[model samples]
Target: MRKINYKDITNQQLIDVRTQHDYQAGHLKNSLNLNPGNFKTYATYYLDLNQPVIFIVGSEEEGHLEELSESANELGFNQKNGYLLIDEVPKEDLQTTETILAEDFLNKSDDFILLDVRHPDEITRPAPEKNLVNIPFEDLVNDYQSLDTSKQIFTLCGSGNRSTAAASFLESKGLNPKVIEGGMKAIQEIGK
Candidate 1:
């Protein structure tokens, strides 16, 4: 993998390696916002190993592109199309979205569709029943179309990280799903 200009790029998946706040502020349209910390374990679930991919890296991750691409290769995704410096992307090409707090979500969850974005193996605790859907964050890329567009969707994962990724992807698809702040851990702490 090597550094490449965004203008010369085409037809490759864009993976954004920015913090959730920076990502929600602005990102390449249709790109998936994945946390770099969980890139190997969680990223694989959302990616197709056969497809060529390019990462749009944040300032903090800029120095680690080679390492990231190496990780991608070791994970069996060898078709890396290189990476882009987030600073180089045109402002017009970026988009933004919103997030919701866990506390706020609890108050009005019944009125919204609750999307449990955690992988099945991660579910060790009970979640609220009303309107809850357990579509793992990885599957949402393909299954988002099946969701009802009329109701608001609240995204949840173990912590707030993966849910933000899910919420950002949903936002790109034109739905306004709020990432439940701090995810299940926050809910559990609040319950306790």
Candidate 2:
């Protein structure tokens, strides 16, 4: 399988396959909004089969980006089209990250910014505690800009997948962000 990273998507066009709520909240710079399931139609209409196209979404579990690419390839979209850029957190660290966030940061909300990487709708529907910001994984690139580089930034999401990836991204940017051991769900249950 070919490997691609978010950093490799500088010049290519981006297709954000997230909800309208997630799209409006924030997304990668210059990403065209579209739902992942409906992307095939859009690909045929607007996206030239000759040019590259990068696809993004809020979460892999929510929308199978990998499967989307496979479908695209099967449909001959990749014959001369652009590559798809998908960001996913490794499964190995998911459990460890969840434990840390719940054990360390949630109770200490005052001491850190609880950066929730889940979609805005997921966090906002139940409404996170006052200090949380729903940046989502797809929007992490944009939301990270306004943050204070010097302060401690904690990353968390639904299961811990997105948050780990997000934490790595911030670390690369020199923010030195901390990943919440588990994620929001873990924090809610274990935290007071």
Worst 10 residues of 2 by lDDT: 89-98
The local lDDT score (0 to 100) that residue 144 gets in candidate 2 is 81
lDDT of 2 by residue, 17-83 (tens): 6553344334464455556554664445434555566666555423466666775676566543333
Among the numbered candidates, top lDDT falls to 1
Q: Estimate each model's TM-score.
A: 0.84, 0.48
lDDT of 1 by residue, 69-139 (tens): 77888889967568888899889988776677666777783567889988788799767777998888778
Candidate 1: residue 1 lDDT (0-100): 64
Q: lDDT per prediction?
A: 0.81, 0.56
**Model 2 misplacement above 4 A:** 2-99, 124-130
Top model by TM-score, which number?
1
Q: Which stretches of candidate 1 lie over 4 Å from their true place?
A: 42-45
Reference-based lDDT, residue 41, model 2? 45
